[model samples]
Target: MKYNNYYFKLKSYARNYNINPQTKKYYNLDFAYLVELSKLDMYIRKIILELSLDVEHYLKVRLLNDLSDNSKEDGYNIVGLFLQYHRNAGADIQSKADKYSFCSDLAEKHLDEYKEPKKLAVWNIVELLSFGNFMELYELYYQTYPSFNYSDYLKSIKFIRNAAAHNNCILSTLRKPNSLKKFSKTKKLANILGKIPEFRELENRDAMMRNPVIHDFVTLLFVYNDVMKVSATKNVRNKKMEEIRHLFCDEDGRIRKNKIYFEKNPYIKESYSFICSIIKYIDKKNKNPKHTNFLQ
Candidate 1:
């Protein structure tokens, strides 16, 4: 979190170019194999970043709207409610006080009634909460609107986001609940896959559950549909599908559009396509509410 001025400058440069500085700076021809691996790694990071931004923005906005409703209905002290929840949840309030000070900082700087909880924007308020606190806050919101249980989606996204943001490997095996029912073929998953012929190659639903890229994308689509405007979600899904398809050939089924033998990574494209297919299915399913499976 404490970046030197030089590191900050480089990070800004990397952001402007949409590339990770670690990918560029750590690579040299002497380590040719590593250089090649880094290229594939950078591309996966890029996709994760893009997807996370959309999910985070949509969730924050939706939660803000719900908070606005709660405020209007009961004059709820939303900020106070969050503080109390964290306190009761055994969060070290005094120790992490500084991290949550955006409320106090804003109150003093802008609000006329400085003693009142600051009318912080949802995105700003979320930044102040630890991930655990955020989940608690989200669960409170979910209680009122019980249509989709977004707790699982948020948990899954947090795992993916932390790994992606920290430049950690996301290809690790997923740990699912042991109590969750095992299915030879999940009805929800089978129905989803039935629509996306391109990804029928992913024969095993179990494998998809274990695959981070596929798992993360499916979670994103579920939450995206829940929060975003239906029409907007459709358009977003289409755009994502188009981008995924661009990574490979339609006819020859060759991975990586560039076709440079040295730079191509087939696994990357396979994962991308597999996820894109699910998004496509979700988009189609959205048109009919009964068919929409909020696969928890």
Candidate 2:
């Protein structure tokens, strides 16, 4: 891309990367720095996408199984119940119409014959629903059924998942604090992180969570750990978690690749250290027999 086009995209970031804060003078930004930053973002996004898919798949499987067990049926009835709940809640008509259209398309593509949404099996319905739609279903499922109340965490996971899925630049705003008007810290995650030696201090925890990207990524780790405890596919969870741990915490990991590029930015360096600490903590917890129930 041309320099002007690149600057256009980097306008919001120029203050942090291209200008001297104290001197208040613009300087020529190193193109190599931008390349490294993009590569780092891509690496982070790949990790997030991998773990998010694990969370999404296991969540759907758990929800489907639990709904089937509780309903004591093929679980088709719950679909109607879910739709009815949304309908009674006065969900946007357009949103419902869009969902209907999506389901209709899925039915056409996957089913040999047309089946009404109500007639679709729970697994089929869940398998067909997009991640966003599955979240809506999962939200209602969490409310109506007995489950851990991590529905709130799903919003952050969804945000990061969409960013990764769309190839959005995640590290561009690492230096910026969380600018969200209304952000709530997940107490469960905070408590877990507090137990980790690195985040023992309140200030350290606050500093890390104050950045939105780090906050969301930490939330993903929290959810992934919690879900794996009760996950039916323990082997799969173990394998995936190990892969993630290797990627971020291992000596030959992606984080260690192109390591020099991160040295100039304190925010990026600290953020990487913070995340690696959490991953190492989880790895330790997994290896200790006493904490067998932690992420197993």
Candidate 3:
């Protein structure tokens, strides 16, 4: 929560430029990379989510374990499977075994890290991105897992995931002048994405989810913890980050209104887009890899 002097200097520089807070600091390669790196971290989260589901399903369907049978051995088996998959990808098994062994050792070493119940299951992904955002999370992940890119969905989905993680309800700065209307025109996009059967359902649900979130914090927190939700909230909180950034990191980096500088900037929107896109991509490809599929 404590900020150094550079935060105030960044705030002043941003103010003198008279640009919107969101548009500032983005000019810096480090922070901008941080933004994208945030997405990459959520990309990592998305990857973990599928693994959790796959591992859990493998246990339940294949091993026929019920809800009451959740065990550490099962968790270890899941990690074992992950190591197996990576090994099959032409990875050196000795290297892989050593790696997972370290992870196992580390997971036990930091068992208390999960005692407080992080916003995400650490394994749940989408929720983890919400609190820590992509930039903060991904840096940790990359520092942790450097040789993994087992899925192609990592890049773009990570971008959207970071966007959602940070609450950028509007998605991007690259949108066209009539982007909302254009997206409205593509009401079928949701149907295509299975977000809704039609525009009516999509709009209705979006409105239902949006208003309450803008006005309610608990509801927002609830949905935040649930990755399988239908909330259309992404990029909504980018405005908050933008405002805080420019307000504090102005022309000379002088802190102003913000009492605390966000060290763990969470880009929830990026996480959203990430999980959504992954769900869509996996659905289409799981059955047939050749089918042409796209999401906006």
Candidate 4:
């Protein structure tokens, strides 16, 4: 591979990594460091994608079960109501379903056999919807059922989910502060982190959440811990969390690889420590069921 061509491409996406504004120099940037960063980003994206899928599956099962048990109406009727409440979104979902029916047997049924929303089952409607569309349905359900408000958290997860799914670089701006806007920390996340002694300090929590990537990644962990109830999935989460730990640190919680790279960037190191702390907190909670009830 040509170094200049790859450097130009990297600069196009990660301009902040090209130079340090404080010193007005190249900021110790090099192709080898850039390659390691890309490798780290790829691992992070895989972790996010796997965990987000777990959350999405759990959300679908939990929501559908709750609605079925509580609502007086049948599944088809409830789906119809959702469609009627959000007609444009419903139309768009149906259009996409029709366009891709050839690939999906469920979509084909939704189009050919159950032409109207009233004839389609709630689970089927949910199965056909994308993650973003599913969140819209979740919001609509929340308005009526009045459960724990996950709107803010869901939005953050959606942003990260889409980015990971699209193979975007998550750590391009690790050293740069977010200049777009101030991120509003979710109360539920704050409450959960507050229980852990390491994250009890306001400054610690604020510093971690200020970075957009860290914020979303932590939110994903929060949702996974709070909603994923099945024992099997919990086991999967534990295994995956351990894998993430191995990627950056060892059993003694020491940086394993790219030590100098993380040392030079305080924000990146802090973010890594913050994530490890949360994972450790969660692992402890998982051991003792008495402390596992986070949001309650």
Q: Give per-model TM-scores.
A: 0.57, 0.78, 0.23, 0.84
Selected candidate, larger TM-score, 1 vs 4: 4
Candidate of highest TM-score: 4
Query: Candidate 4 residues 1-296, lDDT tens each?
Result: 36433554355335445466788866656656666666767778888998899888888888887777875646676666677777765666557656755435565555654554336777778877878878878887777678765666898898889889997767776667454376666777767677767678746677677677788888888778777646757777667666666665574433447667646655566777777777777666767766555556
Angstrom error of the Cα, residue 247, model 1: value is: 2.8
| Model 4: residue 220 alpha-carbon error in angstroms | 0.3
Instruction: Write the residue-wise lDDT of candidate 1 on 14-128 in tens digits.
Output: 2112223767652212233333334545566666677777767666666776656654534234555665566643233323443556444533432334233344444455755
Count clashing residue pairs per candidate. Answer: 0, 0, 49, 0
Please give, for residues 113-208, the per-residue lDDT of candidate 2 as tens digits. Answer: 332233555676676567777788788766766566567788889988988899777877777644555666666666666676667864566777
Lowest lDDT 10-mer window, candidate 2?
A: 88-97
lDDT of 3 at 201: 36
Native-to-model Cα distance after best TM-score fit, residue 235 in candidate 3, in Å: 22
TM-score of 3: 0.23
| Alpha-carbon runs more than 4 Å astray in model 3 | 1-73, 87-157, 163-189, 192-198, 201-296
For residue 100, give model 4's deviation from the true position in Å. 4.1
Question: Which candidate leads in lDDT?
Answer: 4
Cα distance off (Å), candidate 3, residue 171: 5.5
TM-score of 2: 0.78
Error of 4 at 109 (Å): 2.4
lDDT, candidate 2, at 53: 95
Off by over 4 Å in 1: 1-37, 69-79, 88-124, 130-132, 171-202, 232-237, 248-273, 279-296
Error of 4 at 61 (Å): 0.9
